[model samples]
Target: MDTLPDPVGSSQMDIETSQAGGTPEVANSAAKPRVRAPVRVEEAPKFDLDTYIANYTGRTRYDRLYLIGTCSPSLANEALKAAIAEAKASKDIIKYEKAVRALSEVAPSDPEATLNSAWVQETQRSVNAQTERLEGELKGYKNNLIKESIRMGTEDLGNHYYRTGDLAAASKAYSRVRDFCTTPNHITSMLFKMVSVSIERGDWLSVQSNVHRLRNSQSKPEDAARNEPKIAAAWALAQMQQGAFLEAANSFLAIPADLGDSYNEVLTPNDVAVYGGLCALASMNREELQRNVLDNQSFRNFLELEPHIRRAIAFFCNFKFRPCLDILESYRPDYLLDVHLQRFLPQLYKRIRTKSIEQYMIPYNRVTLDAMAKIFAPSVIGGEAKPTDISSPFVQELIGLIQDGVLDARIDMEKGLLISNQVDLRSEVQRSTLENFREFNQEAHWRILRAQVLYHGLEIKSDKKFGDGGKGARFSREGAGFD
Candidate 1:
């Protein structure tokens, strides 16, 4: 929570001060930075490049690989080369050119960086020929006035446009298929194509809109069973992008682990595990984590694929803060390189860290600043305590927690301690009671006054005596809130 210039290390504390007992007092928070391990951006993630890439297909593969190529310095050249190869294999000249540009930026000496005008010209000619052919076919089908033939023609054209990376044209072509759709499956297929287009375009709201349409479509039980996992993953991705971590976790948790690579074009079981698990950690309580994640039999299969994430949840549930946090820290770099996770990582990690701080303080009513610092903001060298001074990041975090009401605790600066405050129930009740009585008295007076006005039938006429002609109005007890 502290905006320190130094790289963020895994340290969290919530500080407030108490003059006598548990009452909070505001104090200026300052933090002194102690050395912590600078995050190693070059650290390669646990998975191998080829194996990981093989888990996905379609544009997602390029997006993910390119993201890694751009974000992870250690994997840049390999990822960029892989991306270029994949792009070149596709009919999409746009994809190929984009990948070539990235490779040129990262590894100019690499052969893939070359524009390869020969391949470009060939793809250009092919794309033009294919587009004209598909368009001509669609025109013929339309002239025949056959709905099914028209639908087929439109879908073929959409597929052509998609392959050529003309997403706008592809999306329009796919949408055209909808009007010609004669059955549930046709509509479903059209919707799916639109979803893919929306996802590639980073249009999350469209993804959600189409997923909603898909869910409500007339799919049979078997179809639902086969498609539910894909739908859930897509919906979860949209929710994640929308910043609804808890809702996204619930959606992800609902995904059946048997999904395997069925949704590999957009997501994988490993992704389900990582995205769902991190979202859970950021938003769910220990009990919730246990119930929805560690104990959910249906999702256990996905968890098995990413055991590190499972262990992180387990550690957090067990209140093993240090190890839990360390695990998250180690994996942060990998998640940072993820296409979908990169933008949301800051918010997700912040929530997880803040929640960890809250959980750590749950069992303590009074704890020393040294003790808090040892667990949070520890010196990376020997796990030493950070300075309890106002300048300490640890102290600053505590200051934030106090101000934000995330922690009901106070700091005793001279004593170098955190003193927790329990809500004074008696005071709170008395305050509420006093406020309620005042409201009741005011209501009773207004009602009695109204009764007098009604009894006397005093229909006061508007007069200039009122500063604003319409300002002074009589109570119509009928329109009053209490009424």
Candidate 2:
């Protein structure tokens, strides 16, 4: 194998030539470099929202903590404990203070109990120290810086106090920031917070004023969208408190569900059902209930939450008197607990019952006293026949409905029957048309007579007052009057 190689394929010659710093002959074809495959990144382990939110701290944690605490007390307590521990371990005074106040909201107890807790006591000490340091820093600043500091400090204090459920203190603090807001959005946000606190305190006048500010503020599109739901809900709440049911119902119905769900902390879907249903029942007519309430798809969704309310409305729409009243009567205890509804429950019930009675009588030419009693009388298990006399309360109620024009029918006391007062439209129209024709004929006859007399060169004379002097006037067919 040690024979001499070909000159063109001389491997030894090439090796020797490369060693002697001479270029070697190379093949024209070359292999391509291999491409390494891209590394695959595994998807981040599924995020746990509960665990993620537990890390939230600062003043923003108050509302989130409330929601979590209500839904899962143990998780909220764990999160609170972790925050408190971290705050103390790191010596973060603000975190420790907010965490303690948030604890008070989650599990409210006696003042002494909260004050006696070691963590709360430590938070209080930190708060005092911070306040002293802040005051010391305030004294060294110029007037402008001092005013700016005070303004920022007041707003921060207001937010802190609001989170701690001290509405009065929060309101005072917020009031001091009014003169310092530089932008329209800042002013609007401040007023909105003020309105919220005023609602909590039931100060309707203040709420009205602040809500007015929010409405009149020049807000950008995003800001307006963010604030509209709150404005509508607050206005509706005020209207509800004032017993303006129709206004409240309309307002509540106008809110989008996505936005309205945010107010579940204040008003539940069940409350919406009660408020909207009762208001509509009290104010709307049978046709209106059928058109605006029962048939309205959006409102129907809310009514679906309370089946009995939906059923009651359905019964009323179908003119079923006993069942509608029965449904309302059965749920009377539930409605009584609602502070706003309780005040007007009796009146609303009376109105609904009266409307049902009116509807029941609509198709009848004359209904017997027994039939009226059978419908309006309280429920009986065995369906016993109750002989209702002409003097029964139901009869008097019908008479009242008649008087109120809620029912176009009258009670015949002697005959023991309800007589419908509904007029036949065809007959009424024919009679009216005939009367109009007769009047037109009489006027034409008089005009023809006057025209014939005028054609013969005669003028019509009347002794009626033409002016203040009560002078008589003569008239020709063309209505030319000469006094």
Q: Which stretch of 10 consecutive residues in model 2 shows the poorest summed lDDT?
A: 24-33
Off by over 4 Å in 2: 1-152, 163-165, 294-301, 304-308, 362-365, 380-387, 390-410, 420-427, 433-483
In model 2, how many backbone clashes occur? 0
Cα-lDDT of candidate 2: 0.60
Task: List lDDT for all candidates, in order.
Answer: 0.77, 0.60
| Tens digits of per-residue lDDT for model 1, 100-153 | 665677678988788899987787787778878989999999999999999999
TM-score of each: 0.78, 0.57
lDDT of 2 at 95: 37
For residue 312, give model 2's deviation from the true position in Å.
Answer: 3.2
Question: By TM-score, who's the top model here?
Answer: 1
